[model samples]
Target chain A: MKVHVIGIGLIGGSMVLDIKSLHPDATIYGIDTNESHLAEAITLGVIDKVGTFDDLAEADFVIVSVPVDVALTLMPKVLDAIGDNTIVFEVGSTKIPICEAVANHQRRRNFIATHPIAGTEFSGPSAAIKNLFQGKTNIICEVEKTTFKLQEKALDLFRSLGMRIRYMDPKSHDKHIAYVSHLSHISSFMLGKTVINKEKDEQDIFDMAGSGFESTVRLAKSSPAMWTPIFKQNKKQVVKSLEEYISNLTLFKELLANDDFDAIFNEMQSVNKIKEILNGMKK
Target chain B: MKVHVIGIGLIGGSMVLDIKSLHPDATIYGIDTNESHLAEAITLGVIDKVGTFDDLAEADFVIVSVPVDVALTLMPKVLDAIGDNTIVFEVGSTKIPICEAVANHQRRRNFIATHPIAGTEFSGPSAAIKNLFQGKTNIICEVEKTTFKLQEKALDLFRSLGMRIRYMDPKSHDKHIAYVSHLSHISSFMLGKTVINKEKDEQDIFDMAGSGFESTVRLAKSSPAMWTPIFKQNKKQVVKSLEEYISNLTLFKELLANDDFDAIFNEMQSVNKIKEILNGMKK
Candidate 1:
């Protein structure tokens, strides 16, 4: 099989690794606007070769994995560049824009909009590792928009990477992810910013950063180039999620101000149910 | 040496696990208002025996690992109840109130203030594990208040657990921890609450919680019985830290609302430096 990977960074690069393992004979071509990332992906053996847009015509499958804005612009072009038999898909976080962009395209039946619910707080090809998608959730939005054969082929690849596929409309996918994923990035970034703003002594943070702080602020290390676009593309839903988070924080702050220990305790106790929900998420 | 571990839960139980490895022949007594927890500790071999408050006089070292509000109440009593030779110390998250509670007590010199910056999301005797403190930081506040001999003994135990000890005043310890530790708990709890509030489908949360959301909300699963008192006792400092966090979030929200993607991107880029600080904290 001939496969072409765009935006050869963490998500796309990881896909290359796992997909190669599943189909050892697959020849994976890579593309990225960042020249260095393309070189790094090649050095890391994440792709068989670096390829250009013209190369897309010969590929059997094209994986678009750039920042959402770039992916939106590139989606139709990728469809235009690919042969009739080629399946074009993207692994962007926000799905609505990309889906809407290709909605009226004649080749829309060949494009599948996907958001794989898997990542670490690292970026670039070097961060790619084996089994990045294993046992993870993959949301395939507007799967009905794709031809049955292309959808099944995408599902085969998703299954090969050990992902459980779910179908949703692009709108629901964006809204749901706004709550579960994008809001977390904002919360963590704000947390790191808050601590950095208050504690001038970095040594103090180093000494006191327990596992709790480490986990809570871990997402602050995510790439701005990747995430800023996600938040911007999903602005309305993300803003709603952020408002809910800020409201919850405000209520807790009021409880703290009033020294209403019981209310705070009850609030945390109720939220502690997340433990059960999260425990179910672990493999 | 005879050791009495009060409140026999995660912290105290973990200490007993490490302390017994260091002083194999020492007898460890467990005490808790929760009778079942004491019994579970005994069953799990976390303690040599269950003991009472009256056992304080017989203990050469008293480790008070209870909730902060309870620790504040028990600090003076444990001091009043123990011998001058007994080195009484509490492993509570907040230090100011506990330190202040016993400031003028006649036996104050025998009591040491410590906050070992190590823990897991889980709690209780069953949640205790070996070497939980290894390569972790142990903050000893108000070191001058304790006698040299007692401080050295505490240092010996902390060293045996493979900890690096740093000394700070009670006020500074509470303030710094508010930013790094306490604020993290609040952020995580609020994040969990916010997500749970929006995603009515528990299955959706269980499906979509990536490592980012999982890590960011890990502390939300923490025992409310334990954290409620810590926040209550350190309300002033925590409120201050939380206000800064909320302000930061509000700014980020405004940036999102205005579609100021550059500002959001720059903010996260700066906070990404936390990756280095957190890296230094890892074992």
Candidate 2:
């Protein structure tokens, strides 16, 4: 098996590491815009060798793990460079933009749009770890657009990495992810901003922050370079989710202002069901 | 050592577990309006026996671990019933209300205002676990108001439990905790509410939610019984924090609506400093 990974970072680097372990005979090649990252990934033994677009012709699979914005301009060119037998799949947060980017390409059937719902706040090749997708949901969008043979090959590879596959249209994928992923990043970032701004006025405020605060703001540490484009591409849904989020906050604040402890308790009680949902997600 | 704990929930139960471990000679007594909770505490070995207010007169130490609203009414009574040498402390989230609740009590010198910033999302005796306070901050407020000898007993017990004590005035503690602890809960609860409300329309949306969403919304699983009174007691500061948080969210939304990805990127980048604050908290 010949595998080429582009924009080697946490997701891409992790994917290839699993491939190496699962397919011992596979030869892994990598390309990254950051020369240092490519070098670091090589030093870290994340990839077997460095490769360029010219190497795509001989690759069995090409994993595109660049930022959503970069994926927009790079997906078509990647499709142009791949051989007829090559399968190219891009893993990004938002789907419709990437799906539409190559909807008219000559080798459209060679591409698959997927978002394996997995990651940590950290990024870069050095941050990658193996088995990140194990038991994680991998939402494959526009699977019908990809040729059956290529889809089978990609699905088999993903399955080998222990990813649970779920099929959805690109539109639903983007909208649903806005609530689950994109909106959460915004909520976390803004929470961090609000507290950081207060930290300026109160130097020792963070000393009082506990595990609850840490968990609530953990995603604020996510990579802006990767997230900015996701928010831009999924702007409509992200905006809608934020509006609903802000509205809920405002209502909660109003209940607090009115000294309506009963309403406040009910509000929190209603959302406590998230515990079960999170338990399900954990499994 | 005779120790009586009022409200044998997560905080009180966990504290007694540590107290029992550290002071083998200590006899732990628990009182709760929920009779079943007191029974469960004994079954879980979180407390040695159930006691009433009458037992408070013979207690050497009294730990109040009820909601802030309830604490406002019960604190003075506990202070009244304690022996002259007894040290009584309350571990409620809001300090101002609890501190003022017994400002003029005859046994004010026997009371120490401390908010041990430790707990999990779960509540009740079943959620109690040992060493929950280890390496965690325990904020001591209005220490000057307590008698030196009585304060020593409580401080020594806290130190034995491995808590790092920080002294702050009641006013300062309430205001600072609002931004770090209280506001984060509102943000998390509202985040859960936004996603849960969306889940009604989009049944499978949660399947797309990953660890990031789970982390950001974890505090939503917190007991409303414990939190509603916290928001009620610390209303003013919590309201102020909510306004600032909402304002930041609104601004971030506008930035996204206007396609100002640069600003959005900068926003997250700036708040990325929370990584260090959280790292500091971990220490």
Candidate 3:
């Protein structure tokens, strides 16, 4: 089997690593715009060889894992290069833009739109590790748009990687993700900014910040190179989510200002239900 | 040695457990307004016995770990009851308010204000665990107010438990903590609220939420009874932190609305320095 992977960063690199383990007989070929990343991925054993879009026709499976902005333009070109039997899946955080980008493609039936809800704050090929998708949700949007043969093959591969599959339309996927994923990143970034601005004495932050602060601001460490495009592609939903988040923070401030401890307690107690919601999300 | 712990919940309970391990020969006595907590602590073996303020004279050390509002009234009383030789430490998140609460007490010299910057989102005696303070920061405010002999005893015990101590004025402690600790809780609670409000269909959240969302909103699961008093006690600083956080979110929203992806990328990239700050905080 020939597996071709593009943009071999964390997600793509991790996918190929796991694929190597699962399908050792399959030749893993990597394609990345960054020459260094491709070389590093080979050195790190993330891929068996370097390949390109020209090599797509020979691939049994093609995984496109670039930034969403790059995926928008690359998707149509990728489809044009793949054979009828070859299956392609683009794993990105946002769905609608890429879905629309390939919506009118000649080989649209060969592509599957996936948002694997898994990752760490770190990025890069070196950051990739095996079993990343294990027990994590993989939201596949527009599954009906793909040909039955390729859809079955992709689903089988994703299931083999131990991912729980959930199908949704691109619109709902983008909107809901804006709240659950994108909004968390924005909230974390702003929280980090707020705390950093106030605590100019960096040593003070290092000395006083507890586990709660670390966990709450952990996402602020995510790569801006990858995330900026995601926020851009999902701008409308992202902006709406930010507005709601800012309003909530403003209300919390007012509750504190007015010495309304009861209201503050109630607000927190209600949100405490997230523990159960998160438990459900946990693998 | 006799150690008396007030409000036998997470912090207090955990402290007594560690002290028991470190000083096996010492007697551990628990005191709490909730009768069941005392019974539970004894059952959990968090303490050897239940004691009252009347038994304070026998204590070599007294740990007051109740809510800060409760500490306002309780600190003076705890100080009044302790003998001259008995040292007292109030472990609460805010400092200046409680420091001022017992500023002129006859036994002020016997008390130390400390905030162990460590805890989980979980609360209660059952939530307590051993080694909770190991490799964690214990911020001691107004350490000078405590008698030399008692300060030596308390600092020795904190070190024995593997705590790294940093001394700060009560005013500085509260203001700095508002950014590192208090602001994080507020941000997590608000993020939880925003997501919960928009995802009226909870299944979407459960399926779509990733590790980032879970980590960012984890503090929202914290006990309201524990946090409400901290926020109330440090209202001024907490409000200031919240305003800054809200303003950053507002500015981020404007950047998004304007399609200024470069500025957004730069903003996140700058905040990414939290990686190093947080790394320094790691044990």
Compare the candidates by DockQ and give the number of the best one.
Answer: 3
Q: Candidate 3 on B1-283: residue-level lDDT in tens?
A: 9999998988999999999998899999988889988888999999999888899987999999998889999889888898989999989999988999999999999998999988999887898899999999999988888889989999999999899999999999988988998999999999999999998888989999989999999999999998999998889999998888888999999999999999999999999999999999984
Native contacts conserved, per model: 0.94, 0.90, 0.97
Model 3: how large is the Cα RMSD against the reference? 1.1
lDDT of each: 0.90, 0.90, 0.92
lDDT tens digits, residue span B1-283, model 2: 8989899888999999999988888999999999899889999999999888888888998989998889999998887788888899999898888877798888888899898989889999999999999998899999999998888888889998999999999898989899899999999999999988887843375578889998999999999988998898889999999999999999999999999989888998999988888787776
Using all chains and alpha carbons, the TM-scores for the candidates as numbered come to: 0.98, 0.98, 0.98
Clash pairs (backbone) in predicted model 3: none
Q: What are the candidates' interface root-mean-square deviations?
A: 0.7, 1.2, 0.7
Docking class of 2: high
- Candidate 1, residue A33: the lDDT equals 82
Off by over 4 Å in 3: none
Weakest 10 consecutive residues, lDDT, candidate 1 chain B?
A: B274-283
Q: Model 3 Cα displacement at B198 (Å)?
A: 1.1
Per-residue C-alpha lDDT of model 2 across residues A1-283, encoded as one tens digit per residue? 8999999998999999999999899999999989999899999999999999998998899999999999999999999999999999989999998888998999999999899999999999987899999999999998899999999999999999999999999998988899988988989999888888887853475568888888998999999999999999999999999999999999999999998989999999999988988887777
The number of the candidate with the highest lDDT is: 3
DockQ of each: 0.90, 0.81, 0.91
